[model samples]
Target: MSPSGKPPRAVDIVRRGLLTRPWRSAVEAVRPPWSPQESQFTQACTRCGRCVEACPGGILQRGDGGYPAADFRHGGCTFCYACAGACPEGLFLPRDGRAWDIVATVTAGCLALQAVECRRCQESCADGAIIFRPVAGGLWQPQLNRSACSGCGGCVAGCPVSAIKMEHSHGRSLAGM
Candidate 1:
């Protein structure tokens, strides 16, 4: 109820609920590139800062429990194998294997969906994963190519509306490759 004793509108109530709830579905702990399954990686990792220092992308940081984690806000991963090479423990898999199965996903807060023209996400995507398709009498709609996306998080930080996120692929386990 408002200070004036009026009930809040249904839209306002729904909006508040949505805003309060965690919006980042990919809130799971993000490990460094080429990391083994979470359980094994945690057990094998020695909490050393070598990998963090070796990462040229500046995305790797000390995460919870003093383990290395990737924070893509600074930049996208280049898959340079620096972190893996620097790690003293055998916590990472072979560099030839897929780095990770996570992929970029766009949420409803996109400006284009709200009738605003914006293409920052698509432009920042280096892999050409994000494509815009024109809509008749309306703004173009962005579509994500999950297959093409390297899950490097290139488009996340550049999004003007903060609509991009990295989510685990469907039918894939977050732990295993």
Candidate 2:
């Protein structure tokens, strides 16, 4: 309630929530085309973990706060888009001809850096999008060969640390892919 007797705005409340942390604010600011549904659905989601279990591709996971977040870089998302169908909250986005629409970024847990033997991230790639190469010390690093990648997110699902990320393609490729 305010002196004017009007109710506080919901956007104001969201602003406060985001202002609490710069990192979170930045993350919230970088919303992808699919993010509106993600934000709206996450708010509505009860955090039941049911959708996580239902995901055959395993691209979905509970965030540190125990909310569903799609980690796409560590591995890749099959983009079967089933998560959208199973989510009671309607959190997942409709892929209808849009599976390749989303672009992803690699920030952490690249199996090539963690363990050379584990090319699971590369091998599991459904679209053959990830290109693995041997580098210094004979280590393999995962790279998204955009030409080959269909943006399926299989690598994102297979990553153990949930390091990979799906973002709007920046029209560039990682150096070591």
Task: Using TM-score, give the best candidate's number.
Answer: 1
Model 2 misplaced regions, further than 4 Å: 1-20, 28-96, 114-116, 171-177
- Candidate achieving the largest lDDT: 1
State each model's CA lDDT, in order: 0.81, 0.56
Candidate 2 worst ten-residue window by lDDT = 26-35
Clashing pairs in 1: none
Tens-place lDDT digits, model 1, residues 1-177: 999999976678677868755643325667887888788888989998899999998888888678888877777899998999998876688988789878888889999878799999899999999999988886798999999999888788788777887777763312111
Candidate 1: which stretches are off by over 4 Å? 1-26, 171-177
Candidate 2 lDDT score at position 115:
67
Candidate 1 vs. true structure, TM-score: 0.80
Shift in Å, residue 100, candidate 2: 5.7
Model 2 Cα lDDT, one tens digit per residue, 21-121: 66453352221114344457557777787766766755566764676655544334545556556666665455554443454455656655776466666
